[model samples]
Every structure is written in structure tokens, then in C-alpha cells.
Target: MSASPAVKALGWRTPLLVIIAGCTIALLNFGVRSGFGLFLEPISIANGWGREVFAFGIAIQTVLWGFGQPFAGAIADRYGSARVLAVGALLYAAGVALTAYAATPLMLNLTLGVLLGMGLAGTSFTVALAAIARMVSPERRSWALGLGTAAGSMGQFLMVPLSQGFIAAWGWQFALLLLSLFALAIIPLSSALAGKAPEGTGPKQSMGEALKEAGNQKSYWLLISGFFVCGFHVSFIQTHLPAYIVDRGLDPQTGAWALALVGLANVVGSYTAGVLGGKRSKKYLLSFIYAARAVVIAVFVMMPMTQVSVLIFAFCMGLLWLSTVPLTSGLVAQIFGPRYMATLFGIVFFSHQVGGFLGVWLGGRLFDASGSYDVVWWISTGLAIFAAIVHWPIDERPLVRVAPAAVAAE
Candidate 1:
């Protein structure tokens, strides 16, 4: 009895703990921000400004998110995610809180655009997924990434209604201030995700070498191209769909619920894609997703506008939404190993944000010009097809640059 070994207790640094913390961070980061679309009408009217002002601020945010991701990711990859996440949470909270006081478009851009964008880059998918990827075994890596993604989608689902309630109860400004508090929650949770995998582990390739290798890979660029479409589709729909629904004479609440449905369905879709990515070909699944997106968007546009149609479209689109994330990140980890996943995936994510910038800003511009979202809708459809076709040619196999001995040395 005395000789019997004591079972090991799970430490705070355990993979499970890391994943739980990371997922919670994802939830808060995505959840608090997902409902920004709901603010467009109220905020714009309050400022006596046109939609472009708000849209431009959001567009700047999108681009800044992309621009900051690579550097944030590189820092996370080299140092650790905890510090990056902590700093991001601070920026996120400050941005949201300060947004309540913004009186001009310039102020809006500074708070929402630069601060919020930078915050999201640190707390969003690339950083979280890369951390989870390194924490779990390869066999469970994809599944864990999906779990993290699903957590983020859950936030999107749950937070939109809560955000709406906040706006309904308080004014929009106070609502923003209240939500800013939620962003601060990420600070404590970031502590559990403190380990840095790249300092001494794995291949000793410099960041530049890793970038060079990925740059030479055709599949990597294909993934980037396809992900850009995902950004475009998501940003456009999330930021403006509520207005679109209102324009169609539907209740604004209908638009909110529609976005929530997308988030809810995304939980299922993201988890399923992650599990499937572990077993199936990531490229084929991606191709199918993009192709399906094109068909879904086309059908939704052609159909008459109704609350039911919008809800249905949202659900369908939600299933395809963040589902691309786990698979795409998995492919990056699969091809490159988990060493520099944050840096590599961050670069891919940058392209996505670029698309997001275009999608959101152009939606406002085009709608303002044409008095209809028709042109943007068609552009989205065409981009979906392009993404679908591009994913088909990606070589899903892992890259092998050196002999076995060299790899062992690495």
C-alpha cells in the first residue's frame, strides 16, 4: 500500500487546461465583437452620419487586424501566447470602452480601428489555434483546433443577443462600455496558456526560412486565397446583414437572430470539420465548403426576402462559416509542423482580413452608390466559386525538404 504510486494530478499547465483557457479567450474575443454589426444603425443615426463613416471605421479595423496578426503571431510563436494575449485583452478593453466617447470618424478609427483590430489579432483564431495545436497530440490536434473554433462560434451565437439586450436596455455608448469589461476577462485566462513551444523545440529554422519555405509551397498560397474569400463573405454578412434585413422591411431583431443562427450552426460545423480534418483530406473538404458557399449564396440571393429565408440562409451559411478555420490551420500544422504555426497561419489570416476590409467597406460604398447590395452579393458569389476552384489544386501532403538524417538533426 505504501509502495503504491500516487496518481498524477493535472497541472494548470496541462494541455486540457491550456485548451480550456484558450477556448474561453476565443469565446470572449469573438463573442464581444461579433455583434458590432448591430451597432451600425444606432451609432450612425446618433452621430448624424452616413453608413460609410461607421463602415470605414470597421474597414480600417479589419485591415489593421490583418496587418497586426503576423507580428503578433510571430511574437507568440517565438516568445509565448500569454503575454500577447494579455496585451491584446488590454487593447480590446480600452478600445471598446473608449469607443463610447468617440465623437468623430477619426476618433472612431483610432479606438475601434487600430486598438480593437490589434486586440483581435492577438486574441483571435490564429493565436489561439496555434497554441492549441502545439498543446495537443497530432492525433487530437485537429479536433482541439475545432473545439477552440466551436467555442468561438458559441460566443458569436450567445453574445449577439446579449449585446442586443445591452443596447436595448442602455444606450449604444453605455452598451459598448459594458461589453468592454468582457474583453478584460481574457487577461487572467491567458496565464494558463503561458508555455512557448518554439524557443528550443523542433526544427531550428529561422522565421525567415520558414516563411521562405511556405512561400514556395503552392498549396499554402491556395489556402491564403481561399481564406480571403472566407473573410470577405463573413465580414460582409456580419457587418451589414442586419441593415440589409432592415432594408428588406424585416425587423432589426430578425437580422440579429439570423446572425446568431449562423453562430449556433457554426459550432456544429466547426467541430465536425475539425474531426473530419483529422481523417479526411483537408483540401477536398475545403473545396466542398467553398463550392457549397457559392451555391448557398446564389440561392439565398435569388429567393425572395423573408424572415424565414434569412434565418435559413444564416443557418446554412453558419455551418460553412468558421469550419474552414480548423482545417486550414491543420493543414498548415500538418505541412510545417507546429513550431511556427502561429507565424505561418497569421500570414494566411492577414489575407483574410484584407478581404474582410474590402468586403465590409465595399459593401457600404456599393450600397450607398447603387442603393442596393446586388453588386456586392454577386461579387461574393463569384469569389466563392473562385475559392472553391482554387482549393481543388492544393497539394495536401506535408513538405519534406531534407533527408531523414537532416530531419532528425532538425
Candidate 2:
């Protein structure tokens, strides 16, 4: 099929607009969600619920977010991202607003878990990056994705403190109401992503063909497996690190700042990963990132607990945190082509969220049972090593169908 004249007419400026809009959406979506950990203690205390109740709600949120991603991507791929994002914005706002009234575990799960999770699936990196991927040239795609991912980190850095402040002044429930208003901002931003998927220079393949091809690839599964470790590490730390810090006799503000530092450092890490991915071996980079994560976690666990150590850990882990995102998503695009980038990446993201579900849930359960987070920390360190090993053997070449016809002919 010939490229549309409109698609052909889209230039660098168009992609810039798309990237800006995408980054904004990512910042807001990820930013708000990242702060949920701050509310863990307060929300639990208010309802006289166990930590497990809050953890389980967030775990369900992670899982549902994972499960919803591909469908959201599929819908965006067919109908356009704007509609999906619009619906997501509404759900996000509603979920946050409704959570204020959630007095039971079941209600919290329905509001925060299902609604917010699905909302994030539509508005977060998976959908936004995919749309940006379709908008830019292949050479520029990695960098664009990195920017979007960094924007989420930026959101984390900015929003965590803001969330803390809100909770401090207005209380958690009122803070959520304020956040609900912030989520509504995505409605206007969705307009920037309002076009059909750009026609690519490569041969066209049906969505079914794309899915089947990805399913058959060993490297694809390997990527998915590695991503699971990322989800596990990140979800656990984000959800529980603040409480852990507080339990260790530090101020709650220290924990909040630590999370903020992770976000701040990750902005640089994510952007660097994106830049390097365009030129380097994404799989090797991914392997190195996982290995580094293992080392960092090991060091953090062994060192005496102190404010200095906590901040250092947060910075180091922050640098490693979400750096895998660009490399992983870029690898998918590199292997499968951007035609199905959203759906394919979403499938991979589901694996990550499965690990996330386990991570968040297990952290709560084990901590409740053993009265310490030591077990989960050690487990994360081990999983990082496992992920590093898994990523090392992934074949990073593009699929034959997506390769240039000359290369395919050879």
C-alpha cells in the first residue's frame, strides 16, 4: 500500500509536537501513580486496615494495568490514541476522586486497582511512546522514546514531593481530590496524538501476523522475562520504600525525598539509555543495567542503614531505575518494527506487571509475616542477577518480514 500524502507530509516538526504531548501525558500519568506509595500508611491507618489491604490494592492495580495495556494499544492502533487517552483520563480522574470515599478493601481495589490501572495503561509510556514511535523517523525513535520515559521520571521527581506536600497540608483524601483534577489535564493533551498511525516505508503486516511472529521469537520471550524483574524491583521499592525508611527510625520526609531522588536521577538515566540505545547494542545495555542493579542492591543491603546510605542508594538505584524501559521497548521496536510496537510492547509490559503484582503483594505479605523487608530486598537482588543473565542471550536482530527486501532476499 502506498503511503498517505498526509503521512508523507508529516515532518520533524510534527514528531516534535507528538513527543511533547506524549511526554506530558506520561509525566502526569506516571507522576500521579508514583505517589501512591506515600498514601499507603495514611490510607491504611484511616480505614484501620492492614498494610496487606493497601498492598493488595496496588498489586491488583499493577496487574490490571499490565493486562489492559495491549488492549488499549490495539484500540489505539486501530481507532487512534486520542479516544483511548480520553477514556483513560476520565477513568483516572474518577478513580482518584472515588478513592476518597473507598472505606473497604473491595471498593479501594475497584477504584484504585482496576480503574486507575486501566487508566494508566491508556495514558502511560506504553501508549504514548508507541504513538511517538509512529510519528518519528526510525533513527530518531529511540531518543524520542527516551524523552517520553524521562518525562515520566520527571513526573515522579516533581510529583512525589508535591504529593507529600499535599498530603501534609490537605491530608491524603483531599490530596487525592487535587490529583484527580490534575489527571483531567490529559483530556486536552490527547488532541496532540489525534492522528491515525503513520504509514511506514516497510512492508505491511496484519496485527495478527505481528502478534504471531512476536510469539514465535525466543528473544521476545527473553525480553519479556527480563522485564519481569524490572517490574518486580520497581513496584516493591516504589510501594514500600517510604514505609521501610520510616520503620528504620528516619523521618517520613526522608523516605519521600529518597523516592524523589530516584525520580530525579532516573530522568538522566532514562535519557542516557535512550540516546545509547540508538547507537549501541540494546540487549547488552539491558544486561549491563540488570547486572548493575544487582550490584547496587547488594551494596545497599549490606551497608549500615543511615540517611547518607539511603540517599546514595536512591541515587544509584534511580540511575538504574527505568533505564531498562527505553532499551527494552526499543528492542521490541527494533525486532518487530513499529507497526505493532504498542501491542507488542504491551505484551512485554504485561510480564513486567505480573512480576510487579508478585513484588508488591509479596513485599506486604512477607513484611507482615516476618516483620522485616530484608527477605524481599534479597529476593530483588537475586532476580536482578537472573534478569541480567536472561538478557545476555537475546538475539537482537530485526525480523525478516520487517527487514528491507534486499536483506530478506539475501
Best by lDDT: 2
Scored against the true structure, residue 311 in model 1 reaches a CA lDDT of 91
Specify the poorest-scoring 10-residue window by lDDT in model 1.
Answer: 1-10
Which window of ten consecutive residues has the lowest lDDT sum in model 2? 4-13
Tens digits of per-residue lDDT for model 2, 294-348: 9999899899889999999999999999999989999999888887888899999
The whole-model lDDT of each prediction reads 0.90, 0.91
TM-scores, one per candidate: 0.95, 0.95
Model 1 alpha-carbon drift over 4 Å, by segment: 1-11, 198-202, 403-410
In the range 1-410, model 1's lDDT, one tens digit per residue, is 22211112224477777889989999999999899999999988998888888998999999999999999999998888999999999999999999888899999999989899998988886798888887667899999999999999999999999999989999899999999999999999999877676342454678899999999999899999999999999999999999999999999889889989999999999999999999999999999998999999999999999988999999999999999999999999998888889999999999999999999999999988888998899999999999989999898777765655786787
Candidate 1's displacement at residue 156, Å, is 0.5
